[model samples]
Target: MRGQTQTASAGGRWRGDGAAAWCWWWVAVVLLLGHLPSCARAGLLESNPGLAYNFYKNSCPSVDSIVRSVTWAQVAANPALPARLLRLHFHDCFVKGCDASILLDTAQSEKTAAPNLSVGGYEVIDAIKAQLERACPGVVSCADIVALAARDAVSYQFKASLWQVETGRRDGTVSLASNTGALPSPFAGFAGLLQSFSDRGLNLTDLVALSGAHTIGVASCSSVTPRLYQGNASSVDPLLDSAYARTLMSSCPNPSPASATVALDGGTPFRFDSGYYTRVQQRQGTLASDAALAQNAAAAQMVADLTNPIKFYAAFSMSMKKMGRVDVLTGANGQIRKQCRQVNTS
Candidate 1:
């Protein structure tokens, strides 16, 4: 994939297709609720409060729980680190809408590669884990800690109540550097992203839902400026907003990879919704991968469907559950490491 293009050939280790249960259930719910108002369809958990609690209990932890587990004063004592962690929610939310793996050095698998612990977030997770170890001992899983930290990070930044996720996930002992390749590149187009998600057994709807993470976080100028400067005929695609495009490119001239890019949701970058879809329709999408989503037939329709906030919310929730299930190193495959950044020296 290059400038103004996308590809899906970078395949990961293929996982089995057992997610069909979740996929089918997701489809049935959407089809049945398709006729209702978006908000009506969205009150899924509100209708069944226990289901919401169950989802959290089965999936991951919440922000408030993790804060209670660790000392923020201790975290802040390390000057360079706190600010780095403040960016954690931003990084994860920007890509996959607050998935914990955003802080996972997915690249930690290779024997020769030094652990590329993601900035300070992973370190923060470890610090919190230590505090939890003293109080709860082995009770809290590192995975849960990271998951809750990420949720708390998002809730804090957005000043919104985050959905509670289930905890009790164990820490991953092995960190694979090659796994970093699995993270979608901003330069990638439609094909690359689809293949990546598909290799993980994610389908088209899952792809669109996962991409909703873009509703939060800032994009760099290098990612979006090309759509404005490159005169690629694809730029004229009606999905893009001309005024928004112009405004984005104005201060972004001679775009450095460091220059700021606008948020997909012109309004709220924190709360999740279909704003990303709207941005794409206006030609304001920030990445070739993002724009390519609108270019494809199946993906584009999902984007269009998302214009209905209720449909988008339900799908977004389901898709998130699906994304959370991808390629997890569970059972005997990988051990839960005490430290995410390093393999056990013993």
Candidate 2:
């Protein structure tokens, strides 16, 4: 899918499939509200008044650059950092609205949850927080660092700034492993995925777009083995492309250890692009949730539409911004943690 050219006619055909209405809705919202100079988007700013485009402009002038520098160095050192950080951010936001609750290290913290056991990049967040602490003391929140680091990590991978992340989020004091259930599972079906997103105020479009992040990451064999070998060892899920199933079976043998990993997008695992959509279209999605996209008519259309790189990038960026705003805590609500790994003692 690397050299494939996105034709205008192809885009037009997708738009004709009742997707144009919601796509136009997003365009109007993004243009009219999202791109404002002050970033005073209604839902985000109106709901969380303390959040702003430059919330730390006076308190921490170098917040964005500091995060970018650390993220750049880490991503350069480890190409896998981007995916880990991005997944970390998603897990953080989904459970508790980008409040950095997932960062807490406690007996029953979100980080200790079963689903989050594999969530890496805590050291990356700690690294960024340490730099911010030196630069601004307690001026910046761990929540904001998580958001900025995720954005910067993706930017580093894309070789450009992907989107603007509104900051000023405060770290929550709570981090319950039980709350991690809010996260969408790799095994969820289409309805379950939609329900999970909808429960977070996200729509179908956001679900489809956010899932595109799989284009760059890997999934543990435990996550995909169930999709590859269901019912009996000899049987494979019929939805999977046979060749892709064979490849997955070879890489992730039956009764494979959870430690084994496979690329989410086999074609271009390291690239941040729309190749995942093509993989999903071909029934080569690495996870059951990913393959679920093709099970629904509307979602399948979205998967088809997002095959266009331009559309995919734009939608992904906007969906990220929207996701970043989920139930955020700002103003004097949550405290700014000096370290990302623990809540404030006082």
Candidate 3:
């Protein structure tokens, strides 16, 4: 409540205790006005004629079931596949707009980028694509497969569909490692994070909500080392909780190997829930970008609001829908690769 302002009723109008209160009051008003519709919100696919819920109804009627079945099998065996797929979908979208460019295996492709080197689930995607090809060859797009696989992966974890993934997205021919610079860095500050989101047409709400995916993932120690071992006098990020810093130090000593890893949400690393916001609130967020949420007043308030499981789920679902639509290739644009790892030679 340090930055929060007090409000009072006076005659017919509400008054703030001070300038900080006025600032917070306006922020609340803006956020209230900007509130997005819930996960059940409809019409996105319908509005875009190129994409549709029943895109493969005539061509590949079993598209949904096939993706779901494969995703469940992989996630069940790996338990970590859900987070990996979600991150894979995100990295794909941010670079070339959810076009499955991240799936390319070229020498200078996005997958070879420094930040993308840790991205996994390519095999899971290939597995899903293989099944789809046999079931309905050349009908389903790799972009749509990536989108659907991500949805099914998370749905498998929650035991229910998280959101509707509209299909008909075509794969892109471009996959430059240089383009991966568009990705938001785990080491970014609040402003940098916001800019990255804005570049992709996402907002502050989307930034906080989508970040909840961190609730179920792990971070490499190399990603956490700067926050734990490099700082002011104490040589620790002051924003990080003291005890939590020591706990991380135990797992990630100075000059920690790139192979070392830690749970992003130490409280519940495998659960897709609101615990991520709670960790950020406690100053125990596992990355610099995660901790940066608490540094901005508006983003901080959004983070606080998202700590509620209900709010987090709804916002995350809506944001996923918006993200799935980013600069997609439809109609006769890009080709659906016969193999996810390479463009169609024909």
Number of the predicted model whose TM-score against the real structure is largest: 2
Candidate 3's displacement at residue 29, Å, is: 25
RMSD of 3: 11.7
The lDDT ranking, best first, is 2, 3, 1
As a TM-score, model 1 comes out at: 0.63
**Candidates' lDDT values, in order?**
0.51, 0.83, 0.82
TM-scores across all candidates?
Answer: 0.63, 0.87, 0.86
* C-alpha lDDT (0 to 100) for residue 259 of candidate 2: 77
Root-mean-square deviation of every model: 12.2, 7.6, 11.7
User: Model 1, 37-134: lDDT tens per residue?
Assistant: 66355563333211123333323233345454353443323322323443443333223223344444444342223222323456667777666555
Q: Which scores greater on TM-score, model 1 or model 2?
A: 2
The segments of candidate 3 whose C-alpha lies over 4 angstroms from its true place after superposition are 1-49, 231-234
Residue lDDT tens for model 3, 253-345: 887787778889989776676889999999999899999999999999999999977667767877888888888999999998999999999
Candidate 2: global Cα-lDDT?
0.83
